[model samples]
Target chain A: MNDQPAASGTPASGGVRIAVDAMGGDHGPAEIVPGALDHAGAHPEDQVLLIGLEAAIRAAAGTLPPNATIVPASQVIEMHEHPALALREKRDASILVASDLVRRGEADALITAGHTGAAMAAAILRIGRLPGVDRPALAVQMIRTGAPFVLLDIGANPDSTAENLAQYARMGAIFAERVLGIPEPRVALLSIGEEKGKGDLRIQRATELLDASGLRFVGNVEGKDVTGDLADVVVTDAVTGNVVLKFFEGLSTFIFDLFRDEFRRSLRGRLAYLLLRPGIARIRDVFDYEKAGGSPLLGVRGAVIITHGRAKRRMIAFGLGVAAETARTGVPALIEEALREDAARLDAAGAGAEGRAEETTLDPEDTP
Target chain B: MNDQPAASGTPASGGVRIAVDAMGGDHGPAEIVPGALDHAGAHPEDQVLLIGLEAAIRAAAGTLPPNATIVPASQVIEMHEHPALALREKRDASILVASDLVRRGEADALITAGHTGAAMAAAILRIGRLPGVDRPALAVQMIRTGAPFVLLDIGANPDSTAENLAQYARMGAIFAERVLGIPEPRVALLSIGEEKGKGDLRIQRATELLDASGLRFVGNVEGKDVTGDLADVVVTDAVTGNVVLKFFEGLSTFIFDLFRDEFRRSLRGRLAYLLLRPGIARIRDVFDYEKAGGSPLLGVRGAVIITHGRAKRRMIAFGLGVAAETARTGVPALIEEALREDAARLDAAGAGAEGRAEETTLDPEDTP
Candidate 1:
């Protein structure tokens, strides 16, 4: 998804305002309240709109700042619930209320570590896609690199269409440029291999379409390339990204599992862990998500960030920080410009195709 | 495919000889020839034969041991060629000759690092699968915890059906217990989540069959559990494993990329890399493939090892080590037990149904 530099050519507001789903996440109101309070306490310049049951929020938050207040949300979206079904049924859900605050102009952005699909659905139904956006995607930050790598449709579209993937490339480029601030960002389509004919049919069509879309396409990249900063925007359908993301997580954990095993080899080895705690901690930070918070649902008219449902208090605070940073930069405006360019290019292509059809008529068998 | 410990199976003898494909891999005959020399030097301990182009083998190996001799092969299988097509056409291919050694009763096992698919195809066509094996599978060790996690079908059958997965699960368990000495090695079907209906249709059906297979079926596991010590044997189609395997490589590289970025942040950080060299080496060790070598083509009539085509001297040595270990323990004997168990169950059920045709109903559903 997209995070912009807060101004996408919209009116500038010095103080950033964000609506956070304090009742969501594994830690619930307990972590959410603390995260909002923590962000408010640290960045007093920003306002946090806490959306959840009033009593529950106040009970966890204790004395919130004058810049923060409870906006009652009657429903709750469970992490395990289906996205579309939950969004349709849970009208006053905290995610819904949070998105509504952003839609109504009461808040600059909304943040949630609840169900990603439900959050996306709520953002789409409430905030809607930006004028040129055909589909919304989850653009996650690869914290391993100091620079961000946007992996679109992380869990949004499991089965991607060629056209949708083409759009994803364009939208992802805008997000990377306007939000992450990488000029002429390298945009790549994730595939099985770097070879031209390596992937399935969708990738085949997508490669051609993306190349013609004029969005700085960098050909096909394998999953390993995603983490190495090989490109700023590594594009793929949500299904592929989801698998890759989970695979990365598993690898990191596998590394840790290996560490524990080595640590237990003998008392002498366990001593090494104690001596090297700082170095190990530093390495851990390189892979930590707490530094970047949540993924943004790009292509939406308004800013809506979706985090993991299993997030704790620290993650919520990071999410808040991310929302504020996004609100400060007007990312929506850049997306609009990119969209207009895409439309004009498509129009010109259509005109060119029509002219070609009139001049080069031939039998199907003889054409090749 | 089939690697069971043959408690009382026929033993290989009668001047059995194997012609090693010496001029292969990244290090070529330099490593392969030495490996052949070592294997031949230990002939009395472990019986086998060696074969390659005579000139190259002699030049690289410097007078081989008495137990090994050169057998001429007209050509070699390059890593870059398509394996299936190459094996079908290249009669005097080195990998083919290695398999031919087994076919001619000159060798009991064939090993190569050229093309996995080509090596597998050559062995299957030349040595063939055991009489009852329906499909052959590749089993490899995924070094995670101190103990290795044996995974099957890394790229053997990526698009397998439910029954194919069932067969793999059985085959994998047998390999683990017989070779790795894990008693009734716990088996698991890999998927995206732990819930009953979390994965694709194949996984769901496989899960049901595994549950009833009377094997030590450990329930459904997420992607993370595959590399952990949660299950002794994890079963999946080759396509998924190939994808997952590449993703893991990417993740590890990503980790390295991040580490490099951290080290380059400042002069002080660069110093940290030097100071933390020991621990960093430990981290690197976690991702090293030296300890994890070639995947064994199980279920085939003879033991065949498929090392990575990119093998360096160390990797080739490790692959040979794995082959020696497999042969020493007689892993194929375990394959026979699992196959026999499955066949016996099917036979008993079929016999019971024959006399009670009207009373007994044929169930089309393979899994719950």
Candidate 2:
């Protein structure tokens, strides 16, 4: 019944297939299997391949929907294990199998709510990176001032250079344009102050590189401006972005909890809360990370979503939607093309002051 | 009939005198003069020296309170002027004059809401750094989970090393103990993740140093745990700290604005707002930077408060109060002593691995 033409390697009449790491996250198969089944049921045009230990997937999935199938893997990567080591030791891990599916072109995308480090490792080691891409960045879609913006390098490579940030700018712009649908995304460098001279040497160098690059560079933006829709894309080193993102999540939760406690304090508060429930829910949804599904591991050869470990069924279903959307847009291919163009521009500029830009070019052999 | 003893160069019976930068901040003398007057009016035992251009200060002063006096400064440093240059060129600038007052012991402390870089520059060049302080760190007091905590290096030195972080831990602990009355404050290094090896090399090295520093090092704290009473002192490089602090302010303001807009949407929402006003106000007050006054520029020879540039009367008054409290508690002296002890401990530990610790020792000639 699927009508959408196969974009990758599935049958011409088959829909986009998503490989899900069902043995991932805190709840393991119990949460992930049903989530995949639900998503498959909801979107009949898409298929889900649940990857995990065979017996556990069977037990947790119960009765799968028509579009859902189980792909058995003998091992599961635990959250605490070292990412690279675990991926090497556990070759048959669910995350690895899911990545392999995407690598082999059997699946259009892979979704994992498991260990972030492991998922990234598997994607890099198996699915590989897009051409002209050195490191894959985690691009998170967040809302600030009633508008959505993308923040990148949110825990990919902590020791990032100016070149890495510049690459992030290119990849992030592509993601913003194709996925977020913002034409000519305004990219900002996250620094301590708005001044070009502010922040550390790395930031200063990145500022120079971004300014010279042909992107719509909107100078420096501080942390205060991050949530104000000042730019379509905010770029930073993984350390800073990860910290800021977590802080945002934590503070939002804390504020909501404070409101909840205050509402329960008195009769007037209770009545007020009842009246304000809809408004509060609206605010909650605006701040909800789950609503955005999860961040994409940008610059990878195939679409991969690294969801939150605490994600529930609904969040996973939404993640499936995100993966499908990414697959449909073919963001990885677009990113590769953009990076190639960016590299060519840098090379044509004679590589005098833009030596850093030259270093970020993806390997030719890796090009699709 | 003030009974408080003079702490500095004031008369034996004179109370703490705080030199106020009357021409500083966005409102200039207009906001600062009234703020100083208010503080002097409320605290009969305290005196305020409002330093600025003579005519402007007098015009804004209106009818000065009993304990408030105006000190004429020929030059007023504009907010945008480079800090070090302004301090050198504008010899009689209000910020410089105020710092001079503290340096001469005519005032126990100095309060400025002007350009932060200029304030730090003026304080460092005029009042000088305490013995054993390589760089002065900014320490901000904030409330999270109903408990007061201190965050340091909140824009003092954007470029920092592991040694600077270790020094901050010492100074921060001292400030927390003496000012915030937290005994043996738990100090945590801010990083992207809680894992020991999660962040960049600087963070990893800082983590190792903190572990061996003999302080109550609480390992690593991610951004999410920074505001939840997870650590009594959260230490980070200036860039990260500044970004996180500003992000907190921005997010809090955004959430409040969201609430305000939601409340105005419908009649029931308006009613709920009327009932919820008290709770909202309480939340606002809790997150108010003004209520906590300005952050103290720690490790300086004299107590200097770097208040917000947009600070109004109430915030300025609170800043004066903070200055008085810092003077009363002898925080600078205590910090110096604690740092000295920490240095000696490191020296006794053979200084084999931590050679950087020796470079931060206070100059013997500069010691109090």
Candidate 3:
């Protein structure tokens, strides 16, 4: 049995319960249900709630494990449907029901590989946000240099303000410290240049705020330095972060296509590729986003992992592993604790902390 | 012997005159002088004015070719010096002198593999801006997929507005059409998503403007689509463009490093790499920054190309080639003509063209 207490309510079997949106993503329950059941079989200490149309889940997963339960969700939000409108119309959508489970403390975490906008909306509208947290950030790990680093606000807040960025840096630092096992993560602001004064007005002001903040501020970092071993947490506005992340996603595919084309160009190339297949796969594995599982939506009240829309069985299982780990470690609670301390520190410094904190405080109903 | 006239002044031998900043960049005169001489030897129709300390240029080149001339500059702008401050203090700096030559019509084009900030400053302060042009942009070519495309505003104006980005699109399209040989170049705005409304406020506003601007507007393209030939010209703010460009630079190096380490891991890997070296070189050649030569500083009144600061003899030579070609094509003159017509179209459409044109007009002395 598990000794860890849930954030609000008791678990069904004294174990971590992860509610999965089986009717989400491209393949939906066909891929998600089996992955959830497999994870449940592997980790008996964790219970998997496969939420979807009950018949679809049962058909996809012929025989579910003892630790897996089917939580029927009546509707599925199509990928192209407007997220806010769909959520409003489809009350029993899988993503909504999964998020509701986390809100009601029936599940410790929620994992979805479906529409990203819908997932974020559900997390904010149902799971709510940590106190004093203006917005939740999507933090993805970059392992290009063989050492994993965190890049946050990847797509959550396209119009992020300096304060939002500062908050993201703090949240990102907590993620790195707790999940990545880094003690006091060195966070850096992503700018055009490595110099502190080289960025735009927002980044310049953010630098000053970060310097005054209690976190280990590593100053400014450029795009070139992000892949290097310079800092553990790299923060940027969601616009830049999202573009950078997509570029990375595009690059892997581009480079691999280039390799394949080159290898097929000649007999020698084909022979060489045959010999170097292992090496190529090794390099591919290092930069594989699927192997990194999912990006965590930090600053929310519960653990939420957003996997790729193209995620399959293996990726879903890996995402479940991340969800379980984050839930067990109580990353959301840790972030809330850190933000409270940060607020207290600002109060001690007499920096108008009370008013600013109030301005960022969000009510669950405020989000769509 | 030559027929193409200089922008304002008669060439020494009725041929293109490119002023090369010999004392700028990491290698300075040692790499620059030889590159200029080699280019001068190859392009008998072009004149190369090597601008630097006379003694240093002579020492680096040993002897200059007939088409190459040494233009003595007493001062050199160090890489780390503040660009505006350095341009004011060191009036005879190599980069400044190069820009001055272009301004006075003594040189048809200016090419510098120096401090990028200094290169832009010199272009703006000494060379001046084209008529009705608000700001100049740096446009670089990306050839990752073996098809080259232009990405603009790489590092020119970090605080770019909607108008600035629109101008960049026009300039980038011109470059792609005339230089890169793309007919009616498709221009796209770089954003977080491909939808017209997917970007920030500036981008969304820019989308509306671009749709009305009468170019081959391709709505919005995300970072993932940049390298894939979705558009010939991709326009963005300097901040995002610079980050994407630098990320590409970093990715090539990182991927190659991974390949090297992976290859060295085992005997089979080593043998495989030895055989695949030729194929690898081909892939490397396609993505090489040095091969791309330089980024054209569009919107300046004179032809200006900013090469990499790490330029060696070969890269410097390639930069000179680009400068000569851009000058010969009269890109700056074409841009001014196009803008005049654009203003006319806006005037006919009753969009307050006169006021906007007047607002954007830059006096030569207004720079630096």
DockQ of each: 0.14, 0.27, 0.27
Residue pairs in clash, model 3: none
The TM-score of candidate 2 is: 0.90
DockQ pick, better of 1 and 3:
3
- TM-score of predicted model 1? 0.76
Off by over 4 Å in 2: A1-14, A62-66, A354-368, B1-14, B62-66, B354-368
Candidate 1 lDDT tens digits, B43-111: 545554555677787788786566666778878878777666676567788887787666655655666
Candidate models: Cα lDDT each: 0.68, 0.80, 0.81
Q: For candidate 2, what is the total of clashing residue pairs? A: 3
Compose the digit string of candidate 1's lDDT tens values, residues A1-368: 23322232353367788888887777789888888889999988888889989999989988888889889998899988866667767788898888777776778878987876577777776766677666677878775547768777666654457777877777777767766778998888776556553455566667777767777777877655666667788777653566566767778876666555655566645665565556567788777877668888777766678877787888888888877777777666667677788778878778444211111111112200
Give candidate 3 regions above 4 Å deviation.
A1-14, A351-368, B1-14, B352-368
**Index of the highest-TM-score prediction:** 3
Chain A TM-scores in order: 0.88, 0.89, 0.91
Residue-level lDDT tens digits of model 3 in A248-320: 8787678878778878988888987888889888887787777667999998888899998888998899899
Docking quality tier of model 1: incorrect
At residue B18, candidate 2 shows an lDDT of 89
Task: Give the TM-score of chain B in candidate 2.
Answer: 0.89
On the 0 to 100 scale, the lDDT of residue B284 in model 1 is 71
Model 1 chain A: ten consecutive residues of lowest lDDT: A355-364
Give the TM-scores of the predictions, in the order they appear. Answer: 0.76, 0.90, 0.91
Summarize candidate 3's per-residue lDDT along B5-41 as a digit string, tens digits. Answer: 3352221334688999898788999998888887898
